[model samples]
Target: MDEANRSDPPKWIQQHAVYQDLMHLDVGDSAQVYAFFLVYMDLTEGEEIAAVVGVSCPELQAVLLEGREKEGEPVQMIYPLPSHRSIKHRELRSILDRGAPMLLCAVASDSSLVYQTV
Candidate 1:
């Protein structure tokens, strides 16, 4: 098969696959996400923010981010989710709004065409 058309491994089987597999893996647009916040986010320790947060996408998407963190929003470290964000969806965003933090593994908020494609 052509490189882009090659079948990918099952998502569950590769959850903890090494980085090498990740490099070779090609997830489709559905698996792409706009951005990732962070992996181990824990906001229960006080009015504190994290040091790292990340945003990522598949090969393509039209997702956009809005609004600056409200006054004094804590900064956090961010890194790509290392996996195709096939699991995240509109529901995840709702969860975030409800103050439930998540380790969003996959999302495609950027692609305006995402709803149609799905």
Candidate 2:
């Protein structure tokens, strides 16, 4: 695995109680969890920009890929996920800025993915 390709979840997600439990119990490695769901806060536009990157679900990946394909950008940034869904930094920032926070939720069958940050 390329060290540069290893991405970590956003700090807010890392500080969440559910995330803490997972880390404490060693339920999964950081890299593996990241492969499924990625969340981050971008503080570039004088405020916090939060985004949730989901690649574990095939349906979502297809939707995003199809959308990107229609947009004329055939290629996207590849991540460590099995499906190979891509998300570039600039695109991520755009998603974070225009995308709503609720869209960041993990869209998967795992009940554990649902959690309240408080």
Candidate 3:
């Protein structure tokens, strides 16, 4: 597999201070919460992504919990697959598509947000 096709965490995840901190968190749930926020950023676009950044931890937790209870908005659908198999195929395609842009956003420990596109 090419470098982009490798099934490994992206380089930004390895280098980001906030992501590093989240990984080191003793509470597994806390780490998952923050991870979900990172995923949320990736799936969101334009103003929605901006709106979610810098939210307090408690607010982030609430949004994550709420998402689990309901279907996500249509705009948030990253793929059109109706089955798990097709979704997995699309995910693999996404991983291999090196030219595709990935957005990385970090919420610092102090609750400040920064965004970068790669």
Candidate 4:
């Protein structure tokens, strides 16, 4: 991985096999889209990777919130994603077209692509 393209996730996250695999994982472009969204997110809470209120897709909202409506959005705080199974953070960021907020497209364990929103 190039220095400019890779990011160091938290040590705890690095311990996870899923995270390790995703760091170098590759998936086909024709992946099935499970859900999509157009969310506004922030990394305020310590390790929680959450989107702001007004998430456009209710289905994606439900997945991220996971029935914790009042607790607030903290999807998961695995920082500096470096890259996802098929796309890199830089590429996603460019797609997002914003500097801070990111476009999150999580690959679920079932091999489905989730939370792909712009």
Candidate 5:
């Protein structure tokens, strides 16, 4: 695989708590399927412990394969981007600006395409 084509989730985010316990965690919508679910944050632990990233919207879409992509195994995401509205989004923006490593999530038309962080 090309170094740029790796789609491993960010190291920090754990599998969803329930999925972690169950071991077989899959995420899918009506037509497609995803085997992994990335956790972006543990908000209940409070802000000081969160892993944040300075990500742009286009960059995010790239992560999801809505933009450019690296070639390799198919990668599909069951969850779409969170709606960026309201005061909470403002705070999320601040976290990214601080240069924290965040679990950026996304999906592609083909599950086999390897998504990369440009």
Candidate 6:
């Protein structure tokens, strides 16, 4: 399998309680979880975002429901981005500013797509 597509959470995330609970969740795949954050944060619409992530809208919706049921209000803690432009940088800044765990997925310079918790 491609390294970028690997499903395992990073070492630090596995050691962190909040991220551990999230990683253990049977919420589709890691990409779906990232899609959930994108949708939940209102960064993008669910259908389009789901398509971009290669997950069906229903599947993404189910993941959202599962996260809500399992993580409760904490699942809704994503910081909203002010704009889609420079979204990744904005998201990283928001995550750092809040000092909270966040799901992030992106295409690297070498064209590898990666998804992980930060």
Candidate 3's C-alpha runs over 4 A off are 1-7, 29-37, 43-45, 49-118
lDDT scores for all predictions? 0.30, 0.33, 0.35, 0.31, 0.29, 0.38
**lDDT, candidate 2, 1-118, per-residue tens:** 1235544566886886645644554424454344333322121122332222222223223212101212333323222222223345654454434333223223222222322211
Model 4 off-target regions past 4 Å?
1-32, 35-84, 103-105, 111-118
Worst 10 residues of 2 by lDDT: 61-70
Candidate number with greatest lDDT: 6
C-alpha-based local distance difference test score of model 2: 0.33
Tens digit per residue, CA lDDT, model 4, 1-118: 2334434434765565543443333321112111211111222242233333322222222222111213654333111221234544555444344223333546443334344334
Candidate 3 lDDT tens digits, 34-113: 44445554444333432232212232121121111124432111111111111244443443253333333344433334
Q: Which is the winner by lDDT between candidate 4 and candidate 6?
A: 6
Tens-digit per-residue lDDT, 19-71, candidate 6: 34544565444544443444443333333122122112232222331122132
Off by over 4 Å in 6: 1-7, 34-118
TM-score of each: 0.19, 0.27, 0.28, 0.23, 0.21, 0.28
lDDT of 5 by residue, 61-115 (tens): 2221121122342332222232221124654454355443333333343333222
lDDT of 1 by residue, 1-118 (tens): 1225434434653463332233343333323221212112222122233333222232223121222123456332222232333335664454344342333233223322211111
Among residues 3 or more apart in sequence or in different chains, the pairs in candidate 2 whose N, CA or C atoms overlap within 3 Å are none
Q: Give the candidate order by descending lDDT.
A: 6, 3, 2, 4, 1, 5
Q: In model 6, what lDDT does residue 19 have?
A: 39
lDDT accuracy of residue 34 in candidate 2: 44
Task: Give per-model CA RMSD.
Answer: 12.5, 14.0, 13.6, 12.6, 15.1, 13.8
